[model samples]
Every structure is written in structure tokens, then in C-alpha cells.
Target: MPFRINSQLAQLIEQHYPAVKTAGFHLSPVAGLTGESWRVSMSSGEMLARFHSPDRQISGADRRREHSILRHIARHNLGPCVRLYSSPWLLVDWLDGAPLAEDAFAGAAQDVLTQSLVKLHHLPLTGYRLDLQQQFAHYWQHIDRRRLTPAWLRLHKKMMRCRPPAPLRLSLVHMDIHAGNVLETPHGLRLIDWEYAADGDIALELAAMVRSNGWNAVQQHALVQRYVDAGGYRDLVLLQQQVNRWLPWVDYLMLMWFEVRWQQTGELKYCEWAQPLRP
Candidate 1:
């Protein structure tokens, strides 16, 4: 379908590439909950432009931080190349690949993903720490308490008391790393969507993978083993403990995110997805 370009986006494109002529514009079939994404084809090449939603569900995401992280990851040939970034709007080189299927993370694909995560964790910190408590509070404050069920409330309380393992080693983590965010490219797996990226507990990253992918115990074990095999972490017990601590918190965050999204879009799908978690 034809994509609509707003005046601001057109102006930004003009400012960046004054001489280039636009050949075509198409909206990507896959849309992000927090933004509208489009593929803009020009005489030079194809680029992906994302217009950030003003009422994005995740309140902790900072566009500047994401831009910085994207630039860093791009330097390592990890994610999309940032072409232009102006608050709430970003344009990156369009990557050609298919998003990983739910069952694709195994064997070689698993190794590639593990290596990528290890590489991502080792990147120089950007001095931003993801505070789960603070993020939870932000989302909770925005949501109407009446919308929360007893089970969710109890889980929230449990999450509040959960503590990270001592001597937490912070790493550059892609806070959202589900199958959808990973692309299977000719070279290897490329992780996209750095909006929630931050320097945080590495275990939280693992927990996010498990939570987002709905991996069973066997699958989760295989993933953890791959991470260990990649030299990402030692002490399986400790890693498991850390992941355990983060799992509930991740669920709570997701619940609140879905709740907020449902409210914003009046979409019953979001509400239905959240119902299973409620009391």
C-alpha cells in the first residue's frame, strides 16, 4: 500500500538528502507497537523510517539513547545502520532479511544468536542503567489501578521485593530480544529494535528472551547452555537464580504494557492477551 509521509518527515528527508529523489514509499507490513515504520525507496537506496508514537507504552525508552546504541551496534555490524535521527523520528538503512520464526532458534541459529548476545553484552556501556523498579513504577503510575486484577497486584508486590544477585555485572542489553526482533540474514542473525536497549543486568536479558519467546524448560536449558558455551556466563546455578528473579518482573512489565496499549488503541487483542495473567 502507498505510505503517507508527513510534512515533518519529508522535511527531515530533504534536510538529510537534498539532492536525492524519492522513487517510492511503502509501509512495512510488520508494525511496531510503539511506532509506525515505513520503507522509503530513493535513487540512492532503500531506507527504513520510524515515526515514534507519542504515547508509547514503554516510558523508559529514550530516543537519543536508542540512536546512540544503534550507532554503536551498527559499527560492529550487528543492527541496521542509522542514517538520520531527530527526536521521535529515525531513519536507518533497510535490512533485507526475514524475521526469525518462533522455532528458528536452534543449532547454528542458536549459536549465532548467542554469539551476538555475547558481543552485545561486551559493548562499552552507555552509562544508562535500566532500573526495573523505576520502569515498573512509571508504567504503573500511568495505568489505572482499577484495571489491575488481584493476581497482577500480587505479582507486582512480589516483583517489588525481588532482588538481583550480588555483584551484578552490568552489560549493554537489548531489553527486547524476542524472535520477532531477530532477523535471519544471509550473514547471520541481526537483532533489531533497540528502543528498549540499556546497560542492565545481563540476567534480565536472558529472562526477556525466555519470556518473550515462551520457551519451555528444555528450550530454555538449550538457550542457557548455548549462552554458556559462547562464554557469556559461568555458574549455571547463579545464572538460573538471576533469571528466576527477573522473570516475574518481566511478566509484570508486560502486563502493564499490554494494559496501557489496550487502553490507548481500544484493541481487544491486547486485553485478551493480558487476561490469562489476571486473577
Candidate 2:
């Protein structure tokens, strides 16, 4: 079984959140990959309680970083996002909906996602700070001790070598846009899991989603066209080239991210899917 919330953390929450204390908080496992998140039920409504890994070495600052990004997104009304109730442990206004599982090109889900990305790209930054190379370097430093294969090493080096494109446009990026990260709510689609959020090329957001979700050629083209139509394509060819070159990097980082999560929660599925990216 995966890790469960300790009694101490539960008490901390009850002490802090008024809603949790009055109606009393009911804790159940919230399906997530990294960090400890739970479905917290109170008299008012449902909320998500996410706990950062206490390890001093990793994920300690992740909570704060995610908090900042979510606040930025929420303030600008970037997307159908959950409201931030607390740092790391957010009390999102429960959006009753499902994950969009259709092909990336079809249905309201596609439109929701495309429009959300465009909105995010145009939103002005308040205090978002991003150092992409340093971020990946930190992950690489931690994972390098495990005897990485030669091909994987090559991918890492190449990813690092690909510098920020000149005349680079800077805007908020969700960084990770996989199927599960998006929720199809009745109000609209709300994006969850802002852990890997950052400020970078908006194209990177679309590219990451496309490559990570394994969108087919037709679906990929459709999504890209939608982005272009939404004013995301002054330099479409360059953006596509950069996105293609960065695929290995994206794959490797995602694989390692899962590997670390497995260690944290004893969740084996994270490592199971990592095999495809293995050299």
C-alpha cells in the first residue's frame, strides 16, 4: 500500500483550517502521483489536502513554489483552476467533473485545454521566477548516482545544451499537461497538479502536453492548429523544432520524476511506465 497521512499532520490541519475543525475533516486517499494529497470533506464542501514530502533534500520548497504559481494563475483567472486554500495543501472549490479521456483533438476537452493554454500564455507574471537549467540540473544530480545508461546520459546532455531561444517569449507555463492533470468540470475544465509549473515559452506547455500524452499525428496537428489560431504561432516552425529536440529531455525528466515519487510513496506504477524511456 502507498503511504498514508500521519496523525500529526492531520492534527496540524484540524488546528489550522476552520472548516476542518467545525464540521470535522474526513480523510480519504486522493489519487495523485507526487506529494501526499487527500480528499478532505467538511460541512461546507470537499477540498484537497496535499502534504509535501518532509525530506529536507527534495520537495521541501516545491509546496511554496506551487503555491506561488497557483496564486498567480488564480489572480489572473488563467484557467478553470482550483482556488488555493492553503500553501501546498489547497482547498479547491470541488469541481465535479471527469478527466478528459478522448483523443486530444476531439470534443469540448480539446477546446477547453487550448483556450486555457492561450489564456495562460497571455497572463502577465507577478513574481514568477524560473531557472530551467538549474531545475533540471538539480534532478540530474540526484538521479546520476543510479548508474544511468549511456543513451539516457546522451539525452540529458543534449537537453541541457538546448538553450533558451533568443527573443524568447516569457509567460506562465503549467509545465506538465498530461491527461490526468486536467479535469473536466461542469463549470469548465480545471487544471490540477501545478507542481512542475514555471515561467517559460508557452509553446513548451503545448509541446509538453502533446509529447507526454502521446497524441497521434492527426490529434497533434489539430491541437497545434488550434494553438496557432489562438495566436500562439509567430514562429511555428522554430517552436516545433525546439519541441521535437526537447522530447528526450521531457521523457527523461518525467521518468526520473516518477522514480522519485515511487521512492516517496512506494507507488510502483510510476516506475513501471518508466521502462519505455529507458535506453
Candidate 3:
């Protein structure tokens, strides 16, 4: 069983953070789909602490990967997320700005986000793997080995056959680009959680953000056009075609993720969401 932080974590906090003068401190649970996250309040300001459950299905390498990526982003002058400390037990940081509001997308914030992503794409990152095809295969193999539902398996296999647009230009992508993951501050937008960061089609991030937000087709088109304009002459046809091809695989990955969550929480809703998305 994963050890839930009850009293020991609180003691650890008092021992580490100087702001917390007393061992008895205020802690509030932060809502998250996976893992235990909290807002720890001291006399001065609050810090965010995220603890990955030992029972969660994440490899040690995954944690190391994110730690390295976050350090790199910090070094590159991205101000959204500030890394205070990282260890196997905790990831601590000063709280970021408020999450972008719902309407933040329709106004100047969209343009700002687009420009930020462009800057991110242009970063001189090397030595990282950007294998979308291989990732798809990994998810599919998990589905088969675990004997997932026939519907899900069928969708996985079908999506596996679809190919990405040829002539791929690999760049560092923020794989998870949702409103919640973005903070709108006076400085600019900041991306969080480098756990999913990797080199891949930048358009995949755009597609995932649009699809997850339920943006209309018009908005999706406008978003892509804006990115293309900022990016300087991207091939729109290839972008959309590749995005369409990857959509099914994205769905498959999401469903498998939910399955893993279900195994942890025994919640039917996680599996329920996967039903409609199944091919």
C-alpha cells in the first residue's frame, strides 16, 4: 500500500522549511487526478508540494526525466514554475500565479500562449528522445498484455496502423498544454509539470489542448493558423493530417491512462470516460 502522508510528512515539513516555525502547520489538499498534492502554508507564503505515491505506475526514470527537464526549463529563463527543491519524497516550489480563467483563451491570452509555445519550440534542446510512434506502440502493447476490452484493443490496433505526416521536424514539445497547466501572470504564461515534456510534433500539443478544451472547429483552425503565422510558414495540410492520424492514438493512450487510474482507485468513471472515446 502507498503510504499516505499523515503525521510524518508534517514533521518533515517543520524540519525542512524554515518558514514553518512549528511542526503543526496548515495543509490543504490540492485537487489532482493522480498523486497527492498539497498547499503548505508558512508564515511568509505558501508552497506547493506534490508527492508521488509509491504505488503509482511510474518508473524511477520518469521522475528523473521530469527533474532534468524542469531544471533545463528553469535554466532557460521560463518564469512560470519555480523549482525550490526535488527529492523522491517531495517536489516543493513557491506557488505560481492563478490558473488561466475560462475566457483567457479567446482574448490576448491566446496570442500570448501561442508566442510562448513558439519560444519553447525554438529552445536548443538536444539528446532527448521524441518517438511518438514508439510511444503509441508502448500503449498498444500494454493494452494487449493486460487483455483490455476488445473495443479498446481494436482502437489501439487501428490507430497503430495510421502514420504520422512524413518529413517530421522534431522539437521539444510541452505534451500537456491545458489551461489548468498554464499560469497567466503579468510576465507571461508559464507551463508546468515537465513530466510529459518531450521532443515530438508541436502540433500534437495544439491538438491535445484544443480537443481537451472542447474548442469549436473555428477556434481550432484559428489556433493552428495563429501558430503557423508565428512559426513562419508551417505546412497546414501536413499538420492537420498528422493531427487527425494521431487523434485515435491519443484517445487510446488516454483510455489506458484511465485504466491504470481505475486499478488504483477502483473508480468506474475513469473506465466510463474511455467507453465513448473507444473506436
User: lDDT (CA) for every model shown?
Assistant: 0.76, 0.64, 0.63
Runs with alpha carbons beyond 4 Å of true place in candidate 1: 1-5, 21-35, 57-59, 106-108, 154-158, 161-167
- Which tens-of-lDDT digit does each residue in 1-279 have in candidate 1? 123335556667777787654554433433642336767677778888876665653545666787888887777878999999987678888888998876676445778888999988888988877777778777777765678668778877877777744424689999888777889888777888888898888888888888877777787777777887888898787787788777777777777777777766778998888776565
Q: Where does the lowest 10-residue lDDT sum fall in candidate 3?
A: 54-63
> How much is the lDDT of residue 29 in candidate 3?
69
Candidate 2 deviant stretches above 4 angstroms: 1-6, 18-22, 32-35, 54-61, 75-90, 104-108, 144-146, 161-164, 258-272
Worst 10 residues of 2 by lDDT: 52-61
What TM-score does candidate 2 get on C-alpha atoms? Answer: 0.80
Which candidate wins on TM-score? Answer: 1
lDDT string for model 2 (108-150, tens) is 5676678778887887864665665666676665553564778
lDDT of 1: 0.76
Instruction: Report the lDDT tens digits of candidate 3 across residue range 1-279.
Output: 123573545766766775577534687767843436667776766666666554332311254555566666765545334444445444546545777887886656888888888888787674576565566665444332553667656766666676654524567777777777888655667776566677666667776777667677788778878888888227877776666655655665666666555555667797687666655
Q: Candidate 3: give the clashing pairs.
A: none
Which of the predicted structures, 2 or 3, would earn the higher TM-score when compared with the native? Answer: 2
